[model samples]
Target: MSTMTVRMNEQDAELVRKFAQFEGVTISDFARTAILEKIEDSYDLQELREAIAQDSGERFSIDEVLTELD
Candidate 1:
């Protein structure tokens, strides 16, 4: 196990502490779990940014999205 230090604003640090307490975990454990969970859910950033850059705001509704899907 490795120990690392990170800096955050007081408000953000307090928020983390509150959430950790609510979840019955140490701040470190809560942060580590949150980080790992997000990484697991994420897609490659390069592909996401490329898709976003090409988006033209042309498809703005559920119907349009369904049309494209079908």
Candidate 2:
């Protein structure tokens, strides 16, 4: 239970209000969800970057994977 105040230009505030109403959510809920989604997106991008960095341009066949599972 906390309160956060955000300052924006009138045009931006109106846009957000309209969008939240269109989506049938309170502005607070819409903003919260948007913030959380952005955070998740950042984490996902970081993981993708790390995986790409670790990739050695190597490919494994299905048989090789199955044999290693034994």
Candidate 3:
């Protein structure tokens, strides 16, 4: 694995350290998880926007589906 360095103000760094300790994880692990989660959230939001844009605005209800099936 490659090592990465992050630069932050001392106050922010202390906050990260404290949060990591509170969560029982190392600072690196905490940062890695936080970064990956942020990326995943952004990807999901983009997908949702694309899906909404492509949507046809069709309406459906479970009862209608069941009636149609019958």
Better of 1 and 2 by TM-score: 2
Off by over 4 Å in 1: 43-70
lDDT against the true structure, per candidate, is 0.88, 0.98, 0.98
TM-scores for all predictions: 0.58, 0.81, 0.86
Error of 1 at 52 (Å): 16
Q: Where is the poorest 10-residue window by lDDT in model 2? A: 1-10
Q: After superposition, how far is residue 14 of candidate 3 from its true place, in Å?
A: 0.5
Higher-lDDT candidate of 1 and 2? 2
Please give the clash total of every predicted structure, in order: 0, 0, 0
Which is the winner by TM-score between candidate 2 and candidate 3? 3
lDDT of candidate 3 over 1-70, digit per residue (tens) = 9899999999999999999999999999999999999999999999999999999999889999999999
The TM-score measured for candidate 3 stands at 0.86
When sorted by lDDT, best at the front, the candidate numbers are 2, 3, 1
